[model samples]
Structures are given as structure tokens and as C-alpha cells.
Target: MESDMTAALIRPVAIKLDEVTKARVKRLAEARHRTSHWLMREAITQYVDREEKREAFRQDTLRAWDEYRSTGLHVRADEADAWLAELEQGKDIEPPPCHK
Candidate 1:
């Protein structure tokens, strides 16, 4: 278990923060009873996670658009609207299938 925890340890990289941001991080770390280093790590982890998700979504959207342009396959708007409205009304609804 200790070895597993050691494997999970992150290597440090140097970063420079402006005075205000450093002060804010210190304050929050004190409030949470944690070190500034731990707070910075958490902040970096969360930011990377969010940005990675956004990048993935962007890539998926680009692939979808290319597929649409190539095959001209898509779901119609009215059918999608009806399906969503049913879901909004507390009904179990499968999505309208994509079609060419």
C-alpha cells in the first residue's frame, strides 16, 4: 500500500504565480488546513482534467462534422425536438437514430 502511494506521488515542476494568486492560494490552503503545494496540485489537477475533457469534446465534434460532410448522415431537428420533449415530460426515450 505504501508502495502504491509512492507510485501515485507527482513529480514537481517549477511554476511562478503573481503575488495576488499566491496570496489567494495561501489563504485557501490555510482555510482547508492544507499546504500551498497541495492546493496548487489540486488546482492543476482540476484544470488539466477540465481542459482535457474540452479537448476530447472538440476532437469528437470535428470527427462528427467530417462524418456528416462525407456521408450527409444526420438526425432531423424536429425528430430530435420531439424526442427531447418526451424526455422532458418524464418519459423514457431513446434518442432519434442518426440516418442518412
Candidate 2:
């Protein structure tokens, strides 16, 4: 299975915002009928989603390079054609195994 080390190192952070920023955020939250905490969580969730996409892109680039170096060919999207074909044939193909 893929190992996710990020979750182990995550911790809740508390920050004190300046009065102006707090007031703006409070106003925004009030308009939306949501608490400050809900607004903060929503902002954090969006940030995390963007960061995850960036990280995934980086990882895929590296993986493509490594695959090319080791196999002397670029990794193609259809590299798993055999496995996909098996599924299309109504075979009960198991999920591809993962590594730690």
C-alpha cells in the first residue's frame, strides 16, 4: 500500500489574526451564516487540495523519469493495457498490488 507519512506529522496550528483581518473574516462568515471556524476549515481544505495536486504532479513527473531511466522507455498511459483488457473481458481482475 502507498505509505502516507504526512498525516503522522500534521498538527493543529493556532494563529492570532490582526483586528482588520479578523473583522473581515468575521463579516464574510456572518454573511455566509457560518462560524469563523467553519470559514477557516473551508480555507484550509481548499489550500490542502491545491497542495495535494502540486505534490501529485511532482511525484508523477519523478516517476516518469525513473521509469524511463530503468526501462529505457517512457511510461505510457496505456502501459496497463493487459490488465485493463482483462477487466473488459469480464474477468474478475484484482486491483493492482501496491508497494509500501
TM-score per candidate, chains pooled: 0.82, 0.53
How many angstroms is residue 92 displaced in model 2 relative to the true structure, after the best TM-score fit?
23
Tens-place lDDT per residue, model 1, 1-100, is 9988987895669999999999999999999999999998899889999999999999999999999999998999999999999999999979998897
Cα lDDT, model 1, residue 28? 97
RMSD of 1: 2.2
- Candidate 1: misplaced stretches above 4 Å? 1-9, 97-99
Q: Residues 1-100, candidate 2, lDDT per residue (tens digit)? A: 1246766666788989999999999999999999998898899899999999999999999998787677775434464676688899999987554322
* Clash pairs for candidate 1: none
Off by over 4 Å in 2: 1-13, 74-100
Candidate lDDT values, in order: 0.94, 0.81
User: Which candidate ranks first by TM-score, i.e. highest?
Assistant: 1
